[model samples]
Target: MNILYIVGEFPKLSQTFILNQITGLIDAGHHVTVLAKKSESNHKIHEDVSKYHLLDHVIYYDENGRDSKFFKGLTFIKSIFSFGYSQLLHKNHPIHLSWKVLLSSPNLILLYNRLKKEPLLDIDVVHAHFGPNGLLAHRLIQMGLIRGQLFTTFHGYDMLRFIKQKGDDVYTDLFQSKTVLLPISNFWKRKLEGMGANPARTIVHHMGIDVDKFEYHPIKMSQDIKIMSIARFVEKKGLIYGIQAVSKLIKKGYNITYSMIGGGPLEKEFRSMISNEGLEDHIRLLGWKTQEQVIEIMKESHVVLLPSVTSHDGDMEGIPVILMEAMAMGKIVVSTYHSGIPELIEHGVNGFLVEERNVDELVHTLADIFSLEDSISISKQARETVLNQYNIDKLNRRLIDTFERKTH
Candidate 1:
């Protein structure tokens, strides 16, 4: 089968789940051509995947046209506004686009023409990554310009955060598609079902992780307890509360070290809080580590933390792939009972769970893990879950099964 994967960013190679899914399809003998918007960051792909072709970018505006204090402030203010009320601020894309496509119009004709040139001929299906992009692909298919079947994966923000308004029946038509509706957790599956999607097409398909990248090592326990989290340093991740918890633990004379990885919008603010709270030594921000580097960090840490929550703007995480990666490495995971997380972490069994954005609970959970005599045994069980369910081998089988069922 030939598949066209439409995404915002492709081949980031930062241990993202989308990359894992792409690689899995290739290994399963499906020819895939990734059509994506290139990122500003200079990232190199894994050598093994260099031969796989990708169309890096398409239509976009020059955001840096005019730089001034007013421009910068306007951009920041716009970001906040767009999130809280996406539908109001957004002009609806046409339900059916015109034959002439342009950046201003975002036409299906232009896209079909561009896609027709791909070397991966005989594309049996067009599988987009998110909802808005799916709307674009859907428009092409609805206009009778594309013969391939249309499909999409609604990652958290695409289905959960996107604002739909009147006259936007794009997803309504898309939901009726025979294409696969793969959600990483039941949370998304239920959300779509409530929105009146085709129940027959929906499947709780998981994004896989390559466990070979993260290996469990026999390391002697350190005197001070350690906690780690690897993600984009954003408001939704709730990294700030973890810092506050470390501060509270230190006041009680507990020895602990908190290591954070990844970089994002909240970098300076997080650093300032760490110093103002006098937690420079305890709270270390290892910004934007590579995939290989993050795997090494997981192996060294005592426990992995993912204190996720819905931000004030409703931006939240789906079941994060990093949590599975941590568990796969035979490390104890300490995360919250946030959206879709419980589906992955069984409280008191695979790892520990607490309420969202609760500092006191984090402190208590940390103390509980430190007090355990057979913590490694608990870690071993956590490892077993990943091997049985979360590893790429198992998840790949699930994905192939879904694809086969959908295509046949």
Candidate 2:
């Protein structure tokens, strides 16, 4: 089956799940194309991106328009006049044109010109990653610009803060037009249903990690425990709390080193906090590592700490893939009981969980893992958990099956 994925940005470091899914589908002998609003980051891209030659299959709408802006403008004007003339000729007949259709005419004109110049492949499924992308696909389809079965996946911000700001009616058109509404976690599935999404059409499909790439190695206990967090320095990640917790532990004369990997808006603030607390020696902020680098760092570290919390804007995680990557590497993880984290982690079984922003509990959990006799067992269990539930090969098969089934 031919699949076209619509996303806000292509080749992003943060949304590796999309890349994994695209590559997994291609490996399974399915043709997939990516249609993104923009391309991002001059930094190194994922290895699979080059291995599969994914850039060849990607279509950036803005980039295409930039090539012949004058021609596109002329075409846009011509299309509007042509459409208006047709409407006038059919004014005697009952013509139903909704406000949405009128509002989307400008974009439709641009899409019409783009398609005339370079047509897209025949698409069996139009899979959109976020709510806004789904809305864009709906508009294009409504204007007869594309043909496919619409499938929308709701991630963290799109379902939470986006809904809070735009209200429930924001997705009313998408919910009506979509063939399926996929949420990465059960928590999000329920939220979508509450917002009037058809329950039968809503499925909880997790974004998985490539387990083979992240080889499992039993964590060896060390006197100086290295705790690493591979997340953006954002409020929802609760990196500030992790820093404070580690600082308190360092004050108690514990031999611990905390390293944060990933860059974001909070980098300056985090650096200031680290300097103000005089944790320059114990804490290091290593910004943005590649997928290969992350695995190597995990091998050197004994624990992965991701203290995720619900942000002020209601943005939260939908079972972070980084946690799965750490678990797949046979590393003990300490994260919060927020969003869909509990679904992946069983307290004291596979990994440890603490209340969101609970510095005392986070510090306590880290101390417990440091001294626990059954640390090896916990690490093994964590690896097993990911292998069983969050493996990319297994999850991608399930996703393909869902896509193959016709949606009424």
Candidate 3:
């Protein structure tokens, strides 16, 4: 089968679940192409899959890659203006918040057109990752160039409030959706169904982790009971609250160390919190490290926490892949029962789940892990869940099955 894959971005440091899916599909002997968002970040996309070598089989396109930086900057400015104009409709414009959301179809049309030619996009199907990104690809198909089926996975943010604030109506224009992969919890899927996705086309496919990458065999085990979380230091991740909880844990002299990976707008604030809380030694903010760094931290740490909460702007985590990665690596996980998190974690069985933004619950969970002996057993259970359910083989098969059926 031929598939054209679209995504917002593919960071070079580490391969996200989309990449894993691409890798798996390509390995299964499917022809594929990737249309990705071009960003100013310095991460490289790993084209190591055998499919990438088979140029006819797999390829990736970055929408902004061909445009000049000056033109891109001007387009960004115009988007901000458009966002402000849309704001006359609402008191607060969540659209105007991030400058990156300014990247739009008009700016990327040429790139998509070029893709239509090279990938011969009329292949069997074109699958996009997020709503807007997928919708952009869908528009290209409507342009009469790419003769193929168009479907997009409504990941998070796009449908969650990010696209809504920009005045993009979710109710209008249906693409030829063969599937809408919602990795989020069932609760999130129910909300999407309420909003207007076809129930028949909707799918609950969790981004599976590569069990080969994370297992019970200790790799980088640190002696101290440590906690690690890899998320953008943003409001939705509950970083601010997580920081407070970690500080509270310190006050109790629990002899714990915490590490926060990934970089974002909240780095300075998180650092400030650590300083004010006098946790310089206990807390480490390892900003934007590579995949290797994350795995190292995950292996060495005793547990990982994903304290996600709905932000003021309605932004929330859509079933973080980081939690799956940690759990896959045989590390105990403590995530909140918010959004679709509970779908992955069953409290007291594999890992523990707490209330969203509950610092007390987070602290208590950590204390519980610290109090247990042969802690590896808990880690073993966490790894078992990932191996059994979140394995890439099963996920890829489900995805391929959907694509083959839908595109045909």
- lDDT, candidate 1, residue 167? 32
Worst 10 residues of 1 by lDDT: 56-65
In model 2, the worst 10-residue window by lDDT is 91-100
Q: Residue by residue across 1-408, what tens digits does model 2's lDDT show? A: 889999977888888999999999999999999988668754778888889999999887766434365765676667657556555355353322343454434445555555644555478888999887787777666555567888888887898887787677888977776568999999999888888999989999999999999988766767898989988788999999999999988888788888899989999999999999998988999988889988888888988999999998889998999999999988999899999999999999999999998999988888878788768788889999999999999999999999989533
Residue 63, model 3: lDDT of 38
The collision pairs in model 3 are 12-44, 185-340
The per-model lDDT (C-alpha) reads: 0.70, 0.83, 0.68
lDDT of 3 by residue, 201-309 (tens): 6777777866786655433333466888888878888878778877887788767788988878989988888988789999998777666567777767777887888
| Superposed model 2: Cα runs more than 4 Å off | 64-113, 116-121
Model 1 clashing residue pairs (backbone): none
Who wins the lDDT comparison? 2
Q: What lDDT tens digits, residue by residue, belong to model 1 across residues 365-390? A: 88777777776766777778778778
